[model samples]
Target: MRTYQTLTVETAGRVAIVTFRRADQLNAMNRLMQGEITESFESLSGDASIGAIVVTGEGRGFMAGADIKEYAAQTGPEFDIFQAAGMRMYAAIENNRKPVIAAVNGFALGGGMELVLCCDLVIANQFAKLGLPEIKLGLIPGGGGTQRSVAKLGRSRANFLLMTGAIVPASEFVAAGLVNEIVEVDRLMPRALELAEMIAAEPAAAIEGLKALTAHAVSGDLDDGLTMERDILGELYRSEIGQQRVKEFAGRSTTKAKKGGP
Candidate 1:
């Protein structure tokens, strides 16, 4: 297990579970929290023992937003620096090689919403609410929310939400394809961990390459994206992780049993 200043990481089987602490403040992102997140994510990315990652909040909510008190106290240059750091943290998550699943347990607004958007998959609790509500504070979702919502949903819906700055229920996000699944609050972590374990069971290299390929293909130039995919896949096939997955699958009786299970 690895400990972070603002988060906790625990490993089970090949999955790394990362939980955002600061439940009292709903895990709001302050400067310290942002720094911890960035470092933790970077470390997790390079940790060979971790095959998959899960991100979740520690208590009643996933995250409310940026720490309003901290934001309010920032001056012009200070605010710019703060926002930049937060944006970089989100970008790190988006570019991570290992698949990361977000387990949204409750309110996920503003920065919280942005955090989930960076994940490869998002599983929100039924009681959870997600939104960009930054407009309400005369601000905007600065951490890829504008681009992600538009790309994931559509221009019209994204525009509506940003303009209105409304909070949408978890089911609404699911309907709009923002969230992968919605489970009861009690089941949120289990569902997320299940997903991580499933990914961990797959060929690690393939999982990493698949995530990078899909993200790059959708977010970058197609020709360059395909080339990157091909290169990564070639390297993956030659790695031990790929060989182990192939051997494990080959011995499985597909007709009688599945590749992996509960």
Candidate 2:
């Protein structure tokens, strides 16, 4: 419900959409924007009414990366502080209990692409351009772009993007597995909201558990991952909604058997 200068939050059913509003700057992440992003996601993660979140930007770009003009003005210690804040912002999205979907409407470059790397799913506009262009600026992604890119995309693809700073079409990464789907600019938001609503309709506990399990599967030891999976499964199985859904499914199965259906 709080107002933000850099972004706006609006809810549709159980899905919350956060839109970056600095259109003139391509919605670049200034220090204010970064802090607001961290605050927004962290707050939404705890909101019981919200089940999923979709992030996008207004006008021509999803995000053009950090506000370089602002970055240029920072002192050495200030820049270090900014880097630390960036980590928190990324973590707030990556570790959010509710699923976060990136609705990349336009250019997602440098730190912008890093933000996408934190989401649970990505639905990009067909014409959207994405890349890590930090190398061109004699810098590298201070966010999780270096690591998450390698994990989501293969090492070869991540290496190319990181090293060359190529801003390619969103479709280029679809086959690489970083993008879930690509749609016409007109369909981008509709498709994203459709997916978010579907996810929002699912059992919240199961969805949250699945999110944690998937994150662990990516980074934890195999044995530990398996144990975590089993624990989460057992927890879900014992939950009230889980038990009710199972009973309902079993009842329908019994009725079908009585009628000799397939």
Candidate 3:
């Protein structure tokens, strides 16, 4: 809800569409931009009216990466401050209660790719190019890309892409399981919203529980993850919304099994 110089949030139905508004800079992640992102996700996560979120860039690029000019001259503490801000934002997206979708329209590199990886689902334009090329800059992806990418795409491919500084096409991204779907640039946002709306239709409690379950499974002990999932799912099933939906589904199944007409 707060005004952001580098970001914009628009509500469509139950979905909150968050756009990185710095197309002029190819949507680079500067300190101010990163701060806005952190604030945006934090605000959206607690808003009851918002059931889902779609993050995208304003124009040609999703995000080119970190602002190189700013990075070129940085004291050690300043560097830490920069990395911390970005990490905070990406982590917020990963742990958001509602589903988060990335509609990557164009170049998504380095920190940009890390941002995409934080999403629950990724939908990119066919022309969108994604990579983590920080090694080429004598740097590394400090925005959680190292962990997230390998978890999603396996260690070999993660190493190849990050080390070689390869820029992969959207098709390759889909094949690698990095992105869920790819479409024309004009259709990217529509597809993202479609997915978001579908997710939003489900009970919020179940959605949040599943999100936590998957994230925990990815980063925690398997036994603990499974236990938490079982407990949370049971709680969801007992909730009023979940019970109503289950009853509705049962009624439909019963009607289908019955021979008599209504």
Q: Write the per-residue lDDT of candidate 3 for residues 38-148, one digit (tens) a residue.
A: 988989999999999999998889999998888878899999888877778888899888899999999999999998989999999989999999999877799999999
Write down the TM-score of every candidate: 0.89, 0.99, 0.96
Off by over 4 Å in 1: 236-262
Q: After superposing candidate 3 on the true structure, give the runs of residues whose Cα lies further than 4 Å from its correct spot.
A: 260-262
Q: Evaluated with lDDT, which candidate comes out highest? A: 2
Residue 31 of model 1, lDDT score: 93
Better of 1 and 2 by lDDT: 2
Total backbone clashes of candidate 1, pairs 3 or more residues apart or in separate chains: 0
Best by TM-score: 2
**Residue pairs with backbone overlap in model 3:** none
Check candidate 1 and list the clashing pairs. none
| Predicted candidate 2 versus true structure: per-residue lDDT over 12-71, tens digit per residue | 999999999999999999999999999999999999999999999999999999999999
Root-mean-square deviation of each candidate, in angstroms?
A: 3.9, 0.7, 1.6
lDDT of each: 0.86, 0.95, 0.90
Clashes of each: 0, 0, 0
